[model samples]
Target: MRTSYFICGIYVLMDLASSDERSFRIYFDEFSIKYKVPDIFEKMDSTLVQLNNRSYINAEMILKRDVADLNVRAIMEFWKPKAQTNMKLYDVRVDGCNLLQSINKNKLFNFYVKSFKKHANVILKCPLKANFSYKMVDWFLDENDLPLFVPLGTFRTITEYFTQKRLAIRVLVHGKVLPKS
Candidate 1:
């Protein structure tokens, strides 16, 4: 028997070794890819930006870093009294290391925003590919949460991260299993 699995917006292929010879099997929930965005982007002026949607990330080296232990800094942009902008910097330790899984699902969004607010004053650099500029700052949890900051009216560039699609999975058994030694 052979089985394939997909979880959390990632395509995962799982093959069962026949040596076990266990007839029974088990499966988990339907996996998905979901995350939070900073409240700043909610503003009308902070239009949706696409990061690496059309083009691929081309780089010689991809570095990894931890977000919890980074020195961060943010610059405040004052335009309108009602609508202000803040550009904070964060240093991600590891890139492409399943950031979504790092945070506990119940408090995932809250944890990220809190991290931004706490570390809003340090020059943070990207841990992954440098050319791939589009990155996530914070995830908003409640309606009361407002924009911490916004960027200038004209953004130099924008990147759209895409949602991973769920692929069809089918499992079948070729033959029955016999007792093991």
Candidate 2:
């Protein structure tokens, strides 16, 4: 299992080795391909823009997955608010394979978030002690004590050899605010 984090996104790669069955590989990659920001101050600018009247901005994210050298197993678009807490997971997959269906009916994918005065922490709790956690971007607040822009964060989980072990790949992202006209 391998984990990588970048200013724009995160990527996780894993290789499953098996003695009887053929080897399987899985990957999870996500990045912010588009955004509008003028400069550093723009990220801190809490004012509502014409594109949206909300204090938070929407970033277009690219989610890609591959399994057993099969490209384009899944591609999706996900949007996240600048500020969030205690997100939930409704699905679990391994190399494009669904694991939630085989797991215990009572088990669930849990995600936790805690904010501090300076920075925030995101935690992904998986079954069988396969957990991932990371300290994310520092929160910027306005004079009114409201968030300006919470940085983007993402994580992925992959299971190797059926049940031999599980790997969790986590990433914390901070992107450059594009210049505004």
Candidate 3:
């Protein structure tokens, strides 16, 4: 018996008989955050004037056996008072095949920051709510025919810092995934 192969544009061709499953470790290599104030009065407040915030986060996803888990670490720094808070996210599990299927079919995916630990000087009375959604704006195939996803999305976080003072931060996140070695 003989078999013929065809390469059409950027699509990758797969064989049904191949027992080898492609294992990919996707890295959330680059991410950025920008803070916004919805109210003009709040932006002009004197106490809030010193609120200069910056954040750096690194995250990665890997397949351990049949389960996929995500690990994320974030450091948020506040100026004026010179304080920083560290947060670590663990045990975030998702079906690896389902995630890839969603990306391939809809070009969109959603994930939750289900658990995290935070240490700060001032604590909030209510827990923060965070939602993350990613939409694939573009993608390309590598030399090995592995697809690299380039997604642009938004992250919204709501927290009550003080009595009757609620802060909502919407960050514009742009990220790319690279296959881990």
Candidate 4:
């Protein structure tokens, strides 16, 4: 079996692990934030950092007031050269409080948490305290723990957070999965 495949002349994707393409990796290409209630943000930033000879995203978000009654909706889309448009891969909306307490109900969400758990000090529960900093230090996708088969491509996630049904913040993350070579 082929170890990897070239698709649409756009990217090379590794075959399943049963093959010899075990060096496929995931990396963040960009991180961005949009504040709906700009005044509510005390500080928010995301940047790339090198640690242990690998790259990671260091992100932090701090609010000016205690945040509660939060809801979250996230959509993940993929861009394939052949499609010429984004294709929705997954979409989920959850009550922030419930999600923190019962992430196991959503395998995708649980997987996300696991990927960042090692390097993040972000609170897992709701009602984020005012002036308290939430952080992800030297956080990168844990390829070894991926729960789904991610094809090689440019992927984007739009994450929106709401308080009392009103949009408070938004996060846009771009990432890519490719052959390590």
Instruction: Name the top lDDT candidate.
Output: 4
- How many clashes show up in model 4? 0
Better of 1 and 3 by TM-score: 3
TM-score of 2: 0.15
In model 3, residue pairs whose N, Cα or C atoms come closer than 3 Å (at least 3 residues apart or on different chains), thus clashing, are: none
Model 2 CA deviation exceeding 4 Å by range: 1-79, 93-163, 166-181
The global C-alpha lDDT for each of the candidates, from Candidate 1 onward, is: 0.25, 0.25, 0.26, 0.77
Q: What's the true lDDT of residue 167 in model 3?
A: 32
- By TM-score, the candidates rank as 4, 3, 1, 2
Most accurate candidate by TM-score:
4
RMSD (CA, angstroms), candidate 3 = 18.0
Better of 2 and 3 by TM-score: 3
- CA error at residue 168 for candidate 2, angstroms: 9.3
List, residue by residue over 80-178, the lDDT tens digit for candidate 3.
Answer: 212244222122323333443343353222222111112121221112212221211112112223333322222222221111233323222322232
lDDT of 2 by residue, 1-181 (tens): 2333552243222112212231221112322221121221112111212222112222211112211221111222223345354243233434312332233332332111122223434221223121222233423212122123333333332222222222222222222222122
User: Model 1 Cα displacement at 179 (Å)?
Assistant: 70
Model 4 lDDT per residue over 11-113, tens place? 4234453344345677677777777886678998888765653558888889898887889999999986466888898898988888888877868788787
